[model samples]
Target: MTAGGARRGNTRFVVAGLFVAFVLAGFVSGYASSHPDGLEKVAEEKGFLGQADDHAFANWPLADYAVSGIGNERLAGGVAGVIGVSIAFVVGGLLVFGAVRLRSRGPGRASAPTGDRGPDDPGPGGPGGVGTDAAGAGAAPAA
Candidate 1:
């Protein structure tokens, strides 16, 4: 791992992935299919579109993919999209980072070793996949 805590050479990949995702979400998504998405289309085809229940928070700001009170529809949609993307990225990153940190610390560590690949770690076969025994002693290779 690097001094910043991210695994060595992984920070670049993560940053690039995030950049690509944000670009796709913020800009490219505007050109996506305008036809009702799966659920809405299904509802319409099923003749239940009129019976669709109203969203409880439909009046909330940034609801229905548009920012409330924004005069320009296009700008409002873009702003709301960007905001949603940013929030999702931040929340997802925090959750993932927290989970990884928590998992890396292990269960009730009592002066555990600093390096990764602990003895309890599973092998390439994964948990109980023939090769990965509880003791981490891999099964013998097939002839």
Candidate 2:
């Protein structure tokens, strides 16, 4: 396919993926099992669950898979899930942007490399080069 068609296809794929992610985060997460999983179940079965301490971030707003201050349990969990997904998406995008910017400039390069032209020089097409002028056609002769 052409470049524009490929780009549009990629965009549609990304949009569909994002839509699925949002739906899962904001809806399906509420249906997740409330019972403790294998590890937690084993701890409880061994009678050591009481001795376990809460996690360091246990008091955070999004802790325990639920958002704080929301009355409905399922709704709170769904909101927390969506918020978590959004935060992760934003952080990932920023990291990709930074990496692309650095790669475009090459290693140890801080600025783009320009042609070796001085202030008084008309190196390319001599005095009337290919650049726009006051009339927006060709470069004007230097004073």
Q: Candidate 1: where is the Cα deviation over 4 Å?
A: 1-5, 107-143
* TM-score of candidate 1 to 2 decimals: 0.61
Best by TM-score: 1
The prediction achieving the highest lDDT against the true structure is 2
Taking the tens digit of each residue's C-alpha lDDT, what string does model 2 give over 81-113? 889888887788787765554333223444448
List residue ranges in candidate 2 displaced over 4 A.
1-6, 47-51, 103-143
TM-score (all chains, Cα) for each model: 0.61, 0.60
Question: Candidate 2, which ten residues in sequence have the lowest lDDT sum?
Answer: 132-141
